[model samples]
Target: MEIPNDSPVNPEQVTSAQERGNPADMAQSGDFNNSNSKKKKAGAEAGTSRGNKSFSIKLAPATNLWTTQKNGAVKLRMEETCCGGVSPLTVAQMFQETVNQCGDHVAIGFKQTNQWETLTFAEYYGECRKAAKSFLKLGLERFHGVGILGFNSPEWLIANVGAVLAGGLAVGIYATNTPEACKYVAQHCEANILVVENAHQLKKILEIQNQLPHLKAIIQYKFALEVHQPNIYMWKAFMKIGEKIPDAKLDEIMDSQMANQCCTLIYTSGTTGIPKAVMLSQDNLTWTANTAGKMVDIKRAGRERVVSFLPMSHVAAQMMDIWIPMKFGAATYFADPDALKGSLVNTLKEVRPTAFLGVPRVWEKIEEKMKETSAESSTLKRKIAIWAKGIGLQAGYNNMYGNTSVPCGFALANSLVFKKVRVLLGLDNCTKYFTGAAPITKDTLEFFLSLGIPIFELYGMSESTGPHTVSQKNYFRITSCGKTMEGCKTKVDKPDELGTGEICFWGRNIFMGYLNMDEQTQEAIDKVGWLHSGDLGKFDEDDFLYITGRIKELIITAGGENIAPIPIEDSVKSKLPIISNAMLIGDKRKFLSMLLTLKCYTDDETGAPLDALAPASVVFCHKHECPATFVSEVLQKNDPLFQKAIQDGIDTVNRRATSNAQKVQKWIILEKDFSIIGGELGPTMKLRRGIVLKMYKDIIESLYVD
Candidate 1:
């Protein structure tokens, strides 16, 4: 388990940028301090010791790979904020703090039976303890991992914390994963217990249970069915087992936990190969929670709220929806995964959250909705909308350049048009909005910015816990992923002529390593402590990180011209409303070509496929808004109009290319869209290049022929 030291940066030299409001602000704001006091009072009133003491850990000092500079190359870390000198070491400890301070506050909210259901902090903590006790009663060993296959639900969060509270590691399995994928994770982690959401997930486990030799029990949370299996247990019955355990024993088990112990195993999406189980320790979780909480300026208890709709299996959702709230005492509203497809907009309207985190696709959908609304508006209203947006874009530029003063004219324009747009999108109350998980086009970012809503793009992976670089509210670049987070140092390893290199990181928030894959782990993390991110990127003059593309994904043409496909692909999709996806093809070929898929939309009223052709332009809809049943018959690649539209889009993208090698010389409109079920898209909705290229080998070859 020893990590070899390789070019470690001096600890004394590593420092984070000064945060907007320091500890003095917390002291000056009596409300902030009073909140903590109230939490302790509430715990005492509830007949429970809040355990307000800090859980400290001695972090190993590792050298940073880059030096601190204003612009040339990114080698910087942010200063850490002292929170009463008590850093939480484990998820259980972090929850204990919230229980003590905000025991009566709403911790989790979800819809059930057409009504909103909520769990208070005290009740949530109690359920976690019960789940932990049940694990102990079931003879689950310390450090043993439990697999959870489900969506974003209150039960999923409870089970995750419960397993960790019981001194066992929790492994989250993506609900969309095939049975074989689920079995691989269970076997690899030696999961002793499996918690599934419903019959659909339970069926997968049952089919592959024989392969999981170490799996001792299966627990179903909802949609319980009649089963006589000896190892299967209903949700209520599972809780009953914990009720029998003495409270003293549960407390002892929680107290025995350590900061460095591994608490969760997050499996990567496996875009390139079989997914790898990432081992994240208690320290990694807590450090990210604390740091990200400050970076986002999360509100004090009772005031902050966020909607949880993303997959719970992903690290971004886990950090934002679960762990960060535990650190800051924020409330998380869980949107039902099944209902999310039909009701995400309505849910956001109802929740009106203070903070929101979305992937690029989510933001793109919102942008499309705005465009559609504009197109449908009256002539004068449409004209006014365009005018207001222009003014807002100017204001956004001012804000990006650190101008605090707003122009009176721009403010007037915002009140006239932008304000209504914000309210309609359920973003009126959102103060902190972020987009990550994949590269977002500048068009999407600018669209939101021009509407007076700033979407900060961040950079990180599961290996970095959640985010390593984030955009600040006052200082942000539309093209960059903000600055390095506090207590974390970043470096561009072996920069090329343009200064682009592999993005490397070393910090307290970095993951311990991949589970049971020592060689792979060692390869990822060098002899020193730096974790080598396969993503290629560079830092701008302001130290804002810009991700170019993946090293493995770089395309070298037959003419020996190096080209980054992401930019070219992103450009085509951004400009062409009809194209759903654009995959560039040119490796070892004389000229570059592309594979394009038409966008599909379902009629809002009847849920039937809508015609792609419009009066003057083609309209594309979000992937989620399109039903799987209608995707196959929506568009024909051989149609003249479709082919002409796609060709025009490719020509437009080519016009912006710096060299001929980067432009698409030919393109084929695909009959079908890339899908997760088809193994063309990853869990995060990113294109699987190898799979796509292989699947259309004939089409690709045809493009190269005369």
Candidate 2:
């Protein structure tokens, strides 16, 4: 798809401002070459070739010393430095190395259905080899598309990396995708084979599998789980055949594909349309792993324990789960879907990971948990939390934007108040945290910091190799998405009071353009190769990039002041209990208003629900007074705990934006929760605001009709 020949800006956009601060300083820090450097560009650098390379996890210093069990079950015994290394390693090779050296090491701590299981490095590598060979035996050729459909599990990853071993690109479908959505991608990419875990996922693919005429095989991970059979291969029986392939030949076949070859199709989870299939080259994947590794400071020590819970189909989890750890041969514990509450907490205590990633939603849950349990703490405990949270936010800002102004008394505060706060959040053992994929409330963002968890908010898209801007260790601007990753150039197309504009990113990690759709691809990447992120941004006087909102999500009132609703919605929702999603409307008209969707957390099954609101008699505005989705019944059941949650949600967003653009007037109690299944959200669960506007067009009009 060719972009329309629209000349919006001058082609030469790489200004000194685009480079942010002293380019020389950043260059020294991140190995960045000046974009304005006199030298011309060349193709990617060929690192150590696979044959000459000992691509094992042991090479990373983090897992230098590991644990050896009496039963011959061994695992990584991490130290602080084990996870340290410049990353971006290939997943298949990481596994190869781990199995080769730490072959006996237990690599996976996975909980499936309800029971936990473990896979040793040797077993994990063997799994990938079989899967890869299975693909080849089933007719996978070089650069072929092998689609993956399922939730986060050992099987999901085994299939994804297996395809890589077979020299095929793994395109993961969101586990919750509708049949129609799945069909669109399968056909769009002309995938050669599709692998799924259970019968349910298979049912969705089977409905539309035939439409994907290019598909030659469908492999189900389980054996006994039978439904109406397709011309499919059972995973266990099929794997038996895969095991027969010689490992050396398998490496020969896959290695020949090279780093520049395409590795996966990462579908965009944009709210209003079919998700776009992001064509990631092997280089893109590795570069992302490399760039993100630098961003998070993934050291070899402690090799940073991580818990894999996010859907691996998306880039964040894919980077953290499938790519980053592969380079380090780090061990990741998988949370069980069933016993997630008890088991997730257990994993944190057991694994004590130093680094991890979470979405705003997950962080919110942690903040809520903190709020719920903190009430029972002593007065001194509460005071320390309040004081320490500010220092944490300052650290976050320092980590993101570059200028650091931590309070003078922080050392005293850290020792006195912040120490215990850290232990309560289970982040006591964690070094740093990554939260991204959507706007996050400042309160929640800072809360982790108060507890001594260095929560970093990052921003970017799959098109940009996962993350472009992230808070560095010393920078922390609550709203800034952090600084540009090393080797990236950023600029705002237009400036507001802040130097805010449409954030355009130019970097080596940018894609090789969207596959097949030359026009659309051309539209996204400008003439000089900057990927138009379509997100609004502003650099502070200090060169921090604050992501205001999506350009497409911008609402221009009749008065011409542009308001971004996310900050506002985030503020309001931060104070609310049981809010499923929030949509801020009233664009191109008068005052700002909103529509809120309220639903209980899936795991929040108790006598009193998270959906419960505060009493109408309280000083706080009830539905009768607020008129926002006034679910009186849910409100009547509201206990103090529930009320505090909702109020905190409200205060969170309210603290972010100015009053006019903030969620000033509101309505609540959407009929349904925003979900992938409900069409209210993107596959990643981001609210598709435009669809919500159109669906509730009349209500939005009513906000201004008077």
Candidate 3:
């Protein structure tokens, strides 16, 4: 039960210390490890290069930002006039600027005891500094990580910024991760302190605490600990630990930080293998927040408000919820933990944020819910909605195609139908709606457009910070990811006759190299500075970027015909209203086959797919004269009516195919729809193709069995 708080861990020891026990622990236990210190010194002399070209403006000399001082770790300036140019500033400095400008403005809001509570910018900043002191007091090593595993909350933000202010990296662990996955991230980052939401998340850490050699303590931020362990502490107690620590000590660590030094570690989904830690520097964060805000025209100070519900572990969520709000002095309201399951709409209505960001799945769910509700409306109301939607769709297309002429009856339609719908969904005040993290079908986009909601698309990955290209409300094509952000540049490498190739990114927002991953980092960033994104895309005459597919996700049939799966999948979903998920599977096979799942009810608590059909799917079945109420019943009866409907829809899609190889030759309905808990989707609700192909291997094999 002894707690090891005697020595500070070295960031250079992350890779080695995970395999071998903590070097500091060995030294304290009379097993002095001289070899570790030698290795650390060797790494320092070798130096880490992010391949960033020299900049005239360097913030400060790299000191103890990492155990091995890295060169080119202070360069945040690039020769670009985008977003009125960029500057070098640590996270601490950026946040302080906001506090100075809007000291009395509300920075964070959360519901407590069925009422709202708020925190001012200065008060929020003060709380973060207190957390930073506690981290330092708990022997948080410079450049070591503070792994936070929790839902989006004020405590999460405080711990994240506090870690950076204390000269450590802020690592957000997905709340849905397993114990083994949690161990990998914590061990990979050499985390000194762990923060969890409640007993459930705490159990994950307890199960793998032994494997995490550098984890010093575990703090539960949500509820009181029923049973206290040696190094376990409550939120209040943890915050008080560094009260006696001097302000000068925390300020000194902040002063030593550099803008280009890595301040955050975002882990990839690990669909292929172990998740890689994406190292985002202070400049990558601060610069992107300021510049992207400008690009989107994010309202300043109290004029902006956003509901924080998306998983903050993802770069998109972190940028939208934490960094952007800090830069603009906007208010962020924390949604309930079950926001993604079903309660999100209630939160949205109450908050009525000025801006909102939803992944493709989130928007799709909202679309489905609206359809279900509309089905139950009176005949006259439905007719009126239909009329309004037609006008709205026409007006939307007119605006998008650069026609300033608004369609006739547009104002009447908006006032009668669109206005009421927005108010009911709590989006009445929202001026901008963004969708990203996956490719959204044109069906979903047009559905929202018909309802007077233009959802902008964002394109980028963890390597590019968050967004490289963004589809703004003013200038956006129907399905394109829009133009690049002001200073960011995109190049399509090795384009074919159609100008389709891999997308590469270049800008100040480009991330520092992955943590402890040299070869992978080199592969990602070339000999020059461009970060080669392994995504296939093309640019139109207007310079708008369109993502075709991922390099790894592309399927090559046995006939040597290459096909992208997204378009085919989207076509199937659009043609068949009952189908919730569609995945094409014909790699190295004679012809393309598909795996489809019918829309079904899901457990509200766990998000587990249920056997009963959803309302929309049930309605579809009734319309087709099929009395089936569950997915199993449809298959058990071999319902020819339902089967023929699906077949006819697939036939329509096949007719539109460019070649025979592109057609879906066969398909089978899955018993359950894909869900995050089912291991078929990532946290952001993006389809996990590899996992799906493996999970249903026998079923897929049966389809192609001669």
Task: Give the candidate number with the greatest lDDT.
Answer: 3
Model 3, 670-690: lDDT tens digits are: 888999999999999999998
| Tens digit of per-residue lDDT, candidate 2, span 1-706 | 1111121111122122112222344311211121332311110101111333554322212221111111111112112332222333455555554455555444555542223344445556656666788787777766667888766766778788888878777888877667876777778767788887677878888788768888888877643446645458666555656555666788787555544445777876533234556766555666567667766678642245578877777787888886776655566666555423445554554445567687766676667676877799899877776777677667545655555566667777778767656554455666777887667767676666565566677888788778888774666566568888775678887677656678898664566555566566777877655688888878877777887667676665432234566656665655654454677775544456667766543324422223333343132445324433334544455555544555556655655432233345545445445665546677776787767777777767766654
Relative to the true structure, how large is the alpha-carbon lDDT of every model? 0.71, 0.60, 0.79
Tally clashes: model 2: 63
Flag the better candidate by TM-score, 1 or 2.
Answer: 1
Please give the lDDT score for candidate 3: 0.79
Candidate 1 TM-score, C-alpha based: 0.72
**Top candidate (TM-score):** 3
Off by over 4 Å in 3: 1-77, 82-84, 554-706
Candidate 3's displacement at residue 441, Å, is 0.9
TM-score of each: 0.72, 0.64, 0.73
